[model samples]
Target: MTEHDDDRPRQPGRTVARSDPGRAMAFSDAVIAIVITVLVLDLRPPDTEPGGLLAGLLDEWPTYLAYAASYVYLAVIWLNHKAAFTRIREMDIGLQWANLGILATLALVPWPTAVIANTARTGNLADERVAVALYAIIGALLCLSWLVFFSYLARHPDLTHDHVDDDYFAHERPRALIGVLLYLAAGAAGVFIHPLVASVIFLVLPVFYGITSHGYDQGPSFLRRGAGSAKSS
Candidate 1:
């Protein structure tokens, strides 16, 4: 028998299944939940007297800002991850590890958020610099994880749903890489500029990415006419 014939099962037209996507999804869900909880823990109680509630709360504006930014960042990642996995039907060992690494990095976000919030409140340059570096490092690693996941998906096109186009591979990779570069730049800028200013610049990334060449709307199959109509209305 030929190699193809020998590899085939005794039953006709049946292929052996490989990899389990569900497990990966479950793991992702658990990690996301934990990350959200950790973010809430970063919120600190006001230090003012009972009658000075308003002043005490106002003093925590930096903490509120940090929480808001971190929350939005996590939401964006979750949305992107969902979009990516929607097309995926299977996962290899490499993909699993990549996802795990992403979750690991996600868990670190709360610490940096807390540090930045505290430092900004106290107006400490050294602490602010350290917090910025930590946040940037996590962002960079998450970007790396995305690169790994995308590479696996590109290599194993068969794992994706039929509606998914091969061009998605080419489109998302560069966008993710550029985001990493921007985060790194923002982190480095914190050394010279105020950390709060650097963070504001970093926040511009999502807006830029949403409108730029590599945005989801720019994909080949995206319904541009429908989107335009919705916007005009």
Candidate 2:
């Protein structure tokens, strides 16, 4: 459909607005870039004598671990966001707010990621677990924001491109639901079990997230794919 066409299939009680999502996508990209940059800033140098710098770095393995895991997780989140927008055709009030919600929680990520790293490095099991619990709570919020964004689109399926299946957004619900549940379970483990275990759970979250991609492949789309390719080139 042409950019100006109000091509989204109409449904009872649904209002369709012809919107260009490019601006919204660009704004989201900027916000996500800032968040990723802040995450890198959280990596602190090992404070030690010149000769002992190697040992100091070794002692701060937890910091490195947390940084790596968080970095990868954020990467996955970005990829997922891009994948979703590929099918999204317009920016409505609800979708705009939903996107903001995801960004809000995502912006909080660097703080908790750093906290987890610093606390884990102290080698205090109790404090580490508390830190893990805090991190898990942040993760839950992030996942919840994603769930909200997806649900909003599901309820208003017309926001997606005509080439996309109406049920596409609805299919995403289960993964988002599972993500919330897993985050809660990890939080429980942090509070009751060991923080190290909870850290592992956080590290593996991207893999669990991959489950959502199983059916997202639509063999590329005439509307979104060509534009995406041009932008990339």
Candidate 3:
């Protein structure tokens, strides 16, 4: 007996198959959870007599500030990651690995947070400089990761929805690039200025980017068309 070949409709062209979005999302969620947990480890128990509540609380202010800043920064990154992934239909192995690397760097945030908080409490310039440098380095890496992930999406337009066009890519690249530059500058400033001041300047980059995103999104039409053809297929 001879077996007949199955007849079925074939997808057009050489399309690359992608992995389950659930797996990627789960991995990201786990990484983020670990990061948040580690952040809490940076908090130190107040050192004072049981009844000296006010003094103990005052002594722990640096820790509180570090915790607050790190928490907010991580939350923002997580939100941005969620936004980027929500538009993704599928993920390639490379993209998954890139995301994992990003998460790994993010998970390391508690170290810098603790260092910075301790340095601030002790008023140690050397320790403060080291902590600030690490913080800025982490920021730069985060920006680079976003750029890498966005570039990957830009390369594989099919993985994203129709509305993600050249304009989004064009606007986003500059934003990420500027963030990288800003973080590097902040790291350099840590050599001279107080770490807290350098960190404040670094934090402003996110605010600036947020304010400019809408305007950049509405920029000249030329960027919209330049790479628009790539997604047409």
Model 2: lowest-lDDT 10 consecutive positions: 211-220
Cα error, residue 195 of model 2, in Å, equals 0.6
* Model 1 agreement with the true structure over 22-95: per-residue lDDT tens digits: 77887798888789778888687887887998998888988888888888777777767777777776665666
> Model 3, 1-233: lDDT tens per residue?
01221122223583566675777888898888888888898676777887997888888887887888777777777766776776666676777877887787788778888888888888778988988998899888888877787776666665655555534554466667777888888988987777777778756765654444432444346544543443354
How far residue 172's Cα lies from its native spot in candidate 2, in Å, is 0.2
Candidate-wise lDDT, in order: 0.71, 0.79, 0.71
Output the lDDT of residue 68, model 1.
84
* Candidate 3: RMSD to truth: 6.7
Better of 1 and 2 by TM-score: 2
Specify the poorest-scoring 10-residue window by lDDT in model 1: 5-14
Q: Sorted on TM-score, highest at the top, how do the candidates line up? A: 2, 1, 3
The clash numbers for all candidates, in the given order, read: 0, 0, 0
Q: By descending lDDT, how would the candidates be arranged?
A: 2, 3, 1
Report how far off residue 67 is in candidate 2 (Å).
0.7
lDDT of 2 by residue, 96-121 (tens): 98999999998998888889888877
Model 3, residue 32: displacement in angstroms?
1.0
Which residues of candidate 1, in runs, are more than 4 Å off?
A: 1-17, 207-233
lDDT of 2: 0.79
Better of 2 and 3 by TM-score: 2
